[model samples]
Target: MRSSMTIVHAPQSDIKMIPSPILTQVESFQHWKNDIIRDIARYRAWLRDNVIYDQRVDKELQLIQARLRDKTLSIAFVGEFSRGKSELINALLFPQSEQRLLPSTLGRTTMCPTELIYEQCSEPYLKLLPIETRQEALPLKHLKQQEDRWLHIPLDINDSKELQNTLSHIGDTKKITVEEAELLGFDCQFLESSSDAHVYVPTWRHALINIDHPLLRQGIRILDTPGLNALGCEPDLTFNLLPDCQAIVFLLNVDSGVTATDMQIWRDHIGQLQDRSATNLFAILNKIDLLWDDFADDEEIKQSVKKMKTLTAQQLNLEESAIFTLSAKQGLHARIKGDEDLLKKSNIAQFETLMFESLIDKKEQSLRKNAIEKTIFLLGNTKATLQAQLKQLEADNRSVIAMLNQGHGEMKSIAQQAKRDQVVYQNQIIALKASKQAIAKQVNTLLLSVNQDHFSTYLETTRTNFKESWSSIGIRESIAHFFTCLESDFTHLEIETNTTIKIVWSIYDKVLANSKLTHNANDDNHPDNTDSNIDKNIDRNIDRNIDRNIGNTIDSNIDNDINNNWDSHSSEQEHDLDLVQPTEFRIFEFNHSLAGLKTKATQYQKSFRSLLSGQRKSTHHFFNSVAAEAQQIHQAAHVEAKAWADGLLIPLIQHATSRKLLLDQKVKVFKALAETNKSQRQKQQELVQFQASIQLQFEDINLMIQSVSQKRPQQSFYESLKLKSTPISSEPQVY
Candidate 1:
């Protein structure tokens, strides 16, 4: 039994007040306002028809609930060549493990993103997949075979030895051979020559290898990227890949400091990703051991540090305090030895602390809080809206019940008509169900017909085109001609050297004029009081001493009076010499210096000349190597293309065709059902009319009840019902 009553009360002064809950949470409502409006419209429609509306509501709620679940936080390590990204990961993970899988040398080591995860299961498995099967998994041993697309390596133990064994198979240090390139499905036409020799390719083209490690399984994904510069001007490796990193560590060699190339890399790659307020960037001064040795004095060491700090700051646009200096090798040693003192001294301890406590932890907390706050706000608004709608629906239902009570006399007559309308609606629902099933079947069939093999064929064709295009350009010959021209320009060093010396002599004459001086004596000829013969001897000695001291200083002590005059005169001469000597002597000194320079320059020219000749001989050999590699790649691409066409594309095509046929079948079924349900349309029309009529009656009944309630003052409905000896029968029942 249910009761429906309508009452009109006097408007309260606070009726205009907005709910505090809604006002307080205005920011939260912004994200869900559109969804909330849509939901309200849907509920109104559902009030007219319950079956369809309830189903949709349930589905929507499920999706919303799923979205509230915890999401994994992914942190990636990314940087240019040999920037120690992989070593950083190793330091974090296997503090004691000595085995290095990622290449630490000058060349590139990682070809693709390799993931390390820990598995609690007993047998450690390595999985490889074919390049064609990007989404599928395969086994490790398959990597050894030329025809095999991918490798899956499973390590049996948790130690460094086991990890090394697994890594060794993939980390082949030898230069890439023509056979290897061909085996890897590269086109041979792009190669310079058709020889069977080895060629070098950049290491970023292969698939990622996953190693089962305990630390990685704990939810850390380390990404090692190729050098900042790409090979052969390839766009994919350079401009396309590096922008997505969340945190960056820029490694600089302490010995070289930051070179022009490093700045170029920064401008081209790192600077582009910077947002000073938001991004966390670390400049690591690596290999700091080069700055000092055990025998280096304290002052020298301090000066070196100061110079390194100043230079790094200027080049990187960072404060001296921001840059961290560390030795990666020494850090690893400290971690293994469990020596905290050594680790602190090694400089990596500060970096480790920043990563673990400051950066990673802060990021995680901020992301989690943001997600939670957003979810709570959305959920709260949704709940409030639902409550308001429920209240309104209750009021509407009460009015309907009252109407039904008032129209009891007409209801029996309408029941027969309503039954017929119900049958019509049921028929329409059945027809719609049939149509939906047909559409689903068609979609499934269509999906099956879409073959993946066609994509592989397309890839192979593109690769072949690229190879032919490279070959047609004849880049090797162009490079050779450029080298030849450069060699010829530097061949006339001896002639240039002679011309430079002649210019030096002309400048020296002007310098010699100011250096000549005349000294005064007591007597015009003889100053000392002595015989002419004795005086002549003394004068000779003095003249000899003066000659020795000219344009130079004499170390021997003389009479104080004589020394004072000489010093004063020499002081005056020193000022004049200082003005002219540097400018004049430098020219002559440079001429002398140029002799050695010219010899070295001539030797360099000869060496380069020999190298040019050797390069000409090697040009053919290099081209042959390139050509062979390209040909091998072309052959492999051909085979792979065929396999892809057969294995993936053909099936997709068939599946698509089948799906289309199924869709056609579904369309036919829906058409037939619609025709069969034509009679049900009339019944549905009658049901709508009867519902409207009943609604009007309920409205009238509610008005009458309200009038009666207003007239009976000083007693509420519930109180009135309680006072009555017999029940007033205010509650109503309806189905």
Candidate 2:
């Protein structure tokens, strides 16, 4: 059995033993374990500081922890208007129910955030609380006002009945009325009193709901977002709440793969938060059932799907495979029929699998294993290399100790020579200091003779020159040029407005003519003996009214017309007009000031010159005093330089010399260690090769032993005797 095992032998020349396989394996295991422990500690600290200790992040962490404990995962359904987001949710969760949370009509829905959670209880209660300034709750009625507040309402019903009733009030497709706005507590005056009166008030119902559903009970929460208009209208709800979702399933109609409105929503809201690693975003090309008509073949549908996927990927900066095509309507039908095979045939099943794998399963596995593997690989190699180097360093240190002792005496002699050189430089520094002091004293005396007040007087003369320059240029003409430019712009605007009014009035006349003929004639017959003059007068009045209305319409559009004209005219006029020319005036002022200052400067120079001529003897006396002070300064500097040379420079030079000696010794030691390391590494390599050979030989012998053991029953007595005799003759191999 032992002979069957592979054995590796060391080379005859290689006395060093490389570690055994068991030891190598243990070392690898230890390295891996140590690195794991370190990484865990590091991650623990980071998690504590960033995720746990920080108040804002702590809440998120706590929520994550709670969700994990509850085995719940949240999927946010988000996109622009009419993207089939709510339809997708219904298809996934409650296909059988006739009621829906979405507003299918041509009006905005989902006014505020709504959360769907699981409740085991049968009787659902509706709880309403108004939004408040702080955490304190307010009355639900308060939300009716035009305040920056929200409301929370819990409805009462076991099924979807209560939800249907509550949402019905806000789900009407008709134009919003003043009465509805008053009931919703919205300020209607802004919409009702405008000259172009238009009512588009948002729905009143806004709350989080807890429903008893199989999906919710299975630990899945869904957020069916409102249309683009509603979300854009209330940006705060979208930005603050949508980003926190674990995953977003963006639904897009397959018929209209991507639209301008979708791009607008993406740019304004989703784009900013798309880069986060924690947020898992997916795109759904929904309503594929619409494409399954007779006109389009399977291949055409496939190509269309591919094109949409590519376009979406390019727009969103994501992988093409991430965007999926599915039919929510088909999925709903498949689910209700209990046809697993049919469900698998649909794209919705593929999307479901993708969501489960990418968002839930794969994400959890990546978070666990990725860092662990990276840390193990990195630290394992590092520890092995460091251990090898450390071993060589220990042997080299012994040689370095001996070399340092040998170089000690020579280092001291070299240091002494450096100190002697430092002394010579110190004497030179003293002479330079004396020369510098003498020059400084002469410069100070030269400065003291000049008067600064004369310079200010000269600057005043420059101001007078600037005033004369302005008079020569004629300021009135410059002002007239500016007014001329202004009048031209105003005239251009008026002309453009008049042209636009003429065109608009022509269109208005045609519209009025058509409208007058279309008016019902039945009211005329019902009138009891109406005066003919009165009817004629009314017709004239109507004509006059139409003219006035058309006039007002032209007036309303005048600003836009003028602005467009200004944009075109300004571009052309910008090159022609350089009216102000302020730069020219500034330059004239600067040059004049400098010219005036020159006269005062010259007078001051003359006064200094005359003083020097009369007081030469006194100047000589001052020079002598200055020279004496310079001599004293020179002496003090000489002493300071000498002290620096002796105390600082000499020691520094000595230290540098000693460092060089130490370095030379270290180099010699390193050379010896290199030779030793080279020899050891060679020995280890040879041992490893020999061990591999032995292992191969051992494996061969094991095969022979197994064959012999198996053939023992079939062998004759003579054959057995021969086999036993063969081992006796090869007794030296046992060694």
Candidate 3:
């Protein structure tokens, strides 16, 4: 086996063993990780400043950024108990240690899931979580929040024996009763089914071996699990932690080959998903020294290893080239003693070369693919959202311009109607003012009358006085009825607007319909004359339909927009309360600093005078509101009617000649807004160019998808992730 492995080795003239690819890749990955972090940070800042926010989207970006910053590539070492799993990790990381850094021997079975990590400028330590936490059904991660539950033992860095003694405790276990096991959330029925008097349980759920190792310092995180039963009991490891791992080193004893348990572990855990390639899903045939049959020749050992490799590959459904057979014990011994020939004989050189050559390269590509996708997705979404809003704003601008252009002949028609409207509205307003004046005079007359003013004063005197003063109190009742009548003004105005709109339409239809007919008596021939009549007829019909359909459209708009989606009656009730309740019929009581009834009565008269003055002022406000509201309703109706009517108006009579300056001013306002939007337009252009560049980036990192199917196009990048884009279809996309 040694000779066969050594024959495949590269010439070692320049091979230095200490700074391996494990460290090399870590450095490469750090750069890649930093670049991704910078990309995400830039994106995060842009999103914050732009106020682009979504709960899911922002959170996803935040998580990716955090993962990039963490930069720890977790390599899970999986195998059955005592399969030299820890030994391989020690050989890979701490090759020069004279003593065993991790618990690895022929008979030792690790009791807990251990995490071997490195911390800069810190002494070595072993942190253990209690076995009692199993009952909480909580992961070690959650229990980590409470520091009191953990036992943290500091290790003396210079004392290797002391460190080994403390680390050896990771394989220690305690015997507990069936009742105690039940308390730990273990099913008592299953334990009782077994014949054991007391169940042996791990003293710790997880262990953290913090050491100052070179590879560990380079952000290498090693997960050393007690492979078989530990994996079965731990749900978090099976689902969350293990799935995110960059690599899983499945170790097997070379003498035993692929055991039934090893195949089960691969099938159920390691080989469950092909998401990570076989290169990352590694299977190590360790303890190859056990395969050394000193009695047999080199050919026999080579044939045995070849058969084992082929069978392991078939069972794990992995490429044979991805698997490696090595003597971890021999390699560790060589590293400790500086024995180069012994290290080469261990068959670890090829594994080291593979690690140094491809581990980081593959990891970098995988990391880049994930990072680029996330960045592109988030940035694409932001660009899409901004683009969508911008497009709508632009569309609105165009619509307004088109509508304004539709009103080219409107103001002339309004100017023509102004004279007629002035005469009619002036008469109606005059009558309204006169009616209001009479009500004021009546109220003024009532204020000065002492008999009416003293009604509230006597009302508190006796029940008999109240009955007698009820007639005077009828003044308050009349005031209440007046407000009710005032609310009818809104209804009256709506009716007035309806009538005015009808009259305008009637006038427009009559004139435009009749104008061309009155042109000539014998104008049946001459192509121009015939064309003129046809044009006039088309104009009349178009304007009439525009008027007819627009009313329905406005009615539809009001129905859709006016409802605030709360209590349908809340708005009406609020409006009714404002117009009525406070001012409505209440007996006037004079509050003063006098004691006598006569003094109060005199004060009551003064109060009544102020009340009358306030009511007159209120009446002025009331009339003004009603008058202004009526004018607005009519103006709105005219706008709706004119929008249609003006479209077909004879330019000679209905052109907006009087309002050219006003129209020009409106143009300038719109032009200013359009000018301000230029920056957003520039951003939009840049975003599109950015999209193309990112699209090319998508093409570069799209290997994972290509691994499945080659026919996929770059356009399907977002489609695969189920993202959408509102593309400006007018612009063609280049491949």
Candidate 4:
């Protein structure tokens, strides 16, 4: 793939340098997002100039802009303690430093799950959440918003030693009694005993590291997790946080192979993440340098490493291509000393290239669908408006030409024909009003299906069931029953929305058909057989002319894309010819979030103790978080349904009403021409001039729609795997 960085060799290095593949792709992705934002802004300006912008469209576009600006590409590193997760993070992000940025000591350096991120407003610091907060009933997300609950430590970015010393505070521990550990939400059976009565536990529950690093400033976030014991105790880490990340890198120790504890961590935490299709999973056999020996040749060592990869993949039930053997220590050493040969042998570069290929494409596709799809719908609205106006102008010019050939008595007959056309427009407007009421009644039923009261009742029933039985079987049954009823509600909402759309579109089709009949009658009465027809022959094929010129306007001036970007599976986009793309109302895609919770619920059921107090704490921890998330999802779905109903029904009625007013204005102009002594030449010239202006405006609208709807081109994967001696400078701030 093409990168934004260039190679620069050191003084003593034998070969030229290569940049980091992941960083290169990240730079390219940031540029691609900026292009999408710019296109949306231009589309909004076009709407305002065309007199079609409204309050609803303005609010929706603002939300989309906010989502693109705040976007972050997050990755999580998960494994048990002593698996080299911390070491791998240090090697990947801080290769140029003289020492490891994060302390990777002999054992359990990262005692809690720590996140590394960059915020422009904040100075360099470490924020720690105390372990005592585990006794509360609030979820982690709510706790994070309260600044007073965390302890903060400041750091100097220029001093590497000071930063390293401050980061080692994450591994600090406290000695507490076994009874005290249980009271603080830790299972006493899993703690390491310092004495007969006391055991060791982590002093903090979570850590947040904010610093000005090159990759972190580009919106690259990293999460370093603790061991199996911590994962079993925290439902927020497994359910709310880990499942939301875009990619996960799970590491294993090569010398120990896949032990029983390693299998427990995989089955309980990392493996369940595969249910979320958006998350990418990969396994690393770290600390491979321990297998190297001087007695064996290079070919023999290669065979041994290949054998380990095959066995590890089979044991984890993953493909061999997803597993790699690498020594984090060797990779860090090679990058610091500018040794290209040692870095190639370490195999870290190969792993990074594959990660870049898998992540960048998926992130780009997701941003396009979320941010650009709505812009395309708005563009379709503008296209339909312009095309309708062009058709009306053509019909009006035909009437003026026929009036020039008539006597005084024939002019009187022509005025009566205009009166008949007004009646046809009036009947169609009445039909649209009746359809509006029918759609409003159906929309209310769809909203009621997803109301908060229904979801609240379901939550209450699940809580009661757990309180009565307090058993593991009760927990499993309650969670399964809760999601089943919620799924039924969504199914009902989908069925109701489709039925409403079909009925409304049928009414709109009848109105269009009636309007066409009125235009054809006007054409038959006003046949332009005089020499004036020859003057208008140059502009006869107005529609085809606009299409040809629009291709050039979009390619040279706008986003250089012309094909339709709306979903092909949408029934409205398929059947409607007027480019009304919003007829197909989409509910939220909540399936991935629901499936991730179900997997975590199953794990929670298995890990609970038999005691009544322990069961109470576990139930409180799991259900409180689930209830809060469900409320937000249900409320959002209701609001979106309301917006879609208004968007689909209101604009259609307004369009029909405005067309009737246009017909009235044309009748008045014809009556004035029949009575007054105005010159026939002056009237004909005015009609012809108005028709030309309508044609130009129609072409401009078509070009603007194409500029916003085109999909962006993707870059090819990079074949070479290598890194520079030093990291490149950070990218410009996107927001």
Candidates' RMSD to native = 43.1, 42.2, 29.3, 11.1
TM-score per candidate, chains pooled: 0.38, 0.37, 0.47, 0.77
lDDT per residue as tens, model 2, 270-304: 55556545567777877777767666676766777
Which model scores highest in lDDT?
A: 4
- For 31-110, candidate 4 gives per-residue lDDT tens digits of 76676677668767755765556666767777777766755878888888888888788777744333456767666778
Best by TM-score: 4
Better structure of 2 and 4 per TM-score: 4
lDDT of 1 by residue, 1-735 (tens): 111111112133432211112111222222233343344344334323422223333333344334322222233454455666666555555442334444444445543444444444535554433322211122222233443454556665445555554553332323467655444332333333334566544342333445554334433345454443322222122222332233456777766777775665565445544442223555676766565466767576656766776787777776554456777766555655555655566667555544333233334334333333323332332233233323433453344344444643232223222222222222222222222332233223322222234333433443344344333233333333333332222222223323322322221221122112211121233333233433354345445434433312212232332334434432443221122211111123223322322232223223222123332222232223222222333343333323222221111122222222322332333234324433344433433443454344334334332332221111233344442234232112100
Q: Ten-residue segment with the worst summed lDDT in candidate 3?
A: 1-10
Clash pairs of candidate 3?
A: 21-356
lDDT (Cα, tens digit) per residue for candidate 3, span 1-735? 000000012224544444344465466657656766665666656445434433444555676677567656677888887788877776776543334567666554576778988877767789998776655534555576787888999987576566656777777666778667545533333222335678666677788888877677777788888755444334345434565567777889877878887876666455643443423677788877775666767777776777888898888876676678888878776665557777777877556545433445455555544445545544543343333333433453455444445743222222222222222222222222222322233233322232222333332333233224334344333433333332233344344334333333333222322323322211332234233454454344435434433443234343232232222323343110111110111111111111122222222223222223333222222222222322333333333333222221112111111122222333343334334434444534433443454344334334322332222222222233221123211101100
Candidate 4 worst ten-residue window by lDDT: 726-735
> Which lDDT value does model 4 have at 221?
89
CA lDDT for candidate 2: 0.40
Scanning candidate 1 in windows of ten residues, the lowest lDDT window is 576-585
lDDT of each model, Cα atoms only? 0.37, 0.40, 0.48, 0.65
Where in model 2 is the C-alpha error above 4 Å?
Answer: 1-72, 95-109, 119-163, 167-196, 340-342, 361-735
